[model samples]
Target: MSYRHTLTAFILAAVITPGAHAQSFDPGSMKTPDGQPDISGTFTFRTLTPFQRPQALADKVALDTEEAAQFEASERIRLNRDLFDPESG
Candidate 1:
């Protein structure tokens, strides 16, 4: 009797487990009716605004367009100064 009960429980669990946790993927979820991947919007993921200003530019609250451009150019030059220097190890 105990063996019969154990067999029944095992069979029930085997039958019920897969459907209980099954997930179906819909390929049309992020696609248009024309079958193209629908990525239609302007995303401001990368903005020109800085998250946190550095302590060196602390006193300056904001920079005009040309001032900001020059600042960025100088920063890039300062950072990549040793790019082509052979002895900059």
Candidate 2:
């Protein structure tokens, strides 16, 4: 009820209770009744290319195998340029 009583209770709780930091992963914990590793949910691999063709390339129908490879190479280089050498802000 009083401030001193409240402070005493808080101090006692702080001293008695141990803080939980983290728990390590245990593969054995994840299991299913069938025991097939319990694989679930969808996994997606993202790419820089969009689903639809850009307005700039609307006129172009399709690229040849070599041309497609070249396009992909150029795109990868352009996208990863900043990652290789980040400019100072």
**Candidate that would win on TM-score:** 2
Best by lDDT: 1
CA lDDT, every prediction? Answer: 0.76, 0.71
lDDT of 1 by residue, 1-89 (tens): 99999999999999998977676567688798888998888866245445678787899878889989988766665666767453743
Predicted structure 2: lDDT: 0.71
TM-score of each: 0.32, 0.35
lDDT of 2 at 37: 82
Candidate 2 residue pairs in backbone clash: none
Model 1, TM vs. native: 0.32
Q: Lowest summed lDDT over 10 consecutive residues: which window, candidate 2? A: 16-25
Which 10-residue span in candidate 1 carries the lowest summed lDDT? 43-52
**lDDT, candidate 2, at 87:** 55
